[model samples]
Target: MDDTGLLVIVDAANVVGSVPDGWWRDRRGAAERLRDRLAAEGVPGHPGPVEIVLVTEGAARGVESVPGVLLDPAQGSGDDRMVDLVAEAGVFFFFFFFSDRELRRRVTSLGADVTGPRAVRPAGGAWAPRRDG
Candidate 1:
């Protein structure tokens, strides 16, 4: 896909925390799952090509990037890193997925359009098992 489309920055912690699906037990796994989902589904609303960056921190820092999803491990705070990304990519149209009020305000001030975790989370609040049989 072209890199010229919208930039989607996903806050790993925030999005994972949005669903209490025992993610606290395996933060890295949770982040990895999010990365894989982004790789498979892309963003729900934006059907165009998008450069998805999953910002990870704390225990989820080492989650690696896949084909479509890029992992950015924050040195300090994921929110700060996301804000920096928004500021750096000021040219591209941005769609940020996270629910922190302060983070939302910070990114919005930097010209980023913000959405909550629901933007990336599963429709039923929990992931359903894929049935390909």
Candidate 2:
């Protein structure tokens, strides 16, 4: 329905913390799993022109770029990187894994939509508009 392009930013650590599956025990594995899930071929229900980015603390150390995704390593905190991405992503539906309310407020202030750290269904993920209720 919306014609705007969407940018989905995944806070790797925050998303891993969303579930109590002990993802912290295997950080890389969890990140990889999330990436794979997002990259799953032929999945249904993704809206138009969706772009996914994964932000993690020190996770992008050696990795430069992913084929269908952008990997960002947080110098201090992944939240900062996420915010920066939202700010830089001009005119796109921005969605990020929501863990901290403060960070959510900051992203909304920058006029970017936000989404959840919840389990991403095969259809797609949950996202909310930045300005509209």
Candidate 3:
């Protein structure tokens, strides 16, 4: 299958919250680190071709711009924005990292294929799909 039609939506806060490394103490730093890791992974084209969007609440205070990585700062709820993105991003293969049952249900209701928890590396790093069961 052509991977070009794939779209990835990252729940920045969720990802940060998943790890117990005091990420909440420094949200901006955590986000920046996540963005850097994601950029290195080459999102849309990693493992296959896919467009990626990183959704976060508030401003992206410390994150830098990276090609193929769209930073979306939600004014209200990131989940709402994610739903909107899924609605508008066409019939591409959608993947999200939210672990919330309701949010996951919402994403799936929108017909997105979701994944989770694994460490997503840059282009040259290993790519292993996170198993959620």
Tens digits of per-residue lDDT, candidate 3, 71-119, equal 8887789888888888887675887876878889987987888876454
Q: Order candidates by lDDT, high to low.
A: 1, 3, 2
For residues 17-60, could you state the per-residue lDDT of candidate 1 as single tens digits?
99977888788878887888889999997888789999999999
Clash pairs detected, candidate 3: 40-122, 41-122, 44-50
Q: State which candidate has the highest TM-score.
A: 1
Candidate 2 stretches with Cα past 4 Å from truth are 1-3, 41-45, 58-65, 119-133
Model 3 alpha-carbon drift over 4 Å, by segment: 1-3, 43-46, 59-64, 119-133
**Ten contiguous residues minimizing lDDT sum, candidate 2:** 121-130
Count of clashing pairs, candidate 1: 0
- State the TM-score for model 3: 0.78
Is candidate 2 or 3 superior in TM-score?
A: 3
User: Each candidate's TM vs. the true structure?
Assistant: 0.91, 0.76, 0.78
Which ten contiguous residues of candidate 1 have the minimum total lDDT? 124-133
Q: List the residue pairs that clash in candidate 1.
A: none
Instruction: Indicate which candidate wins on lDDT.
Output: 1
Assess the local accuracy of residue 14 in candidate 3 as a C-alpha lDDT between 0 and 100.
80
Off by over 4 Å in 1: 1-4, 128-133
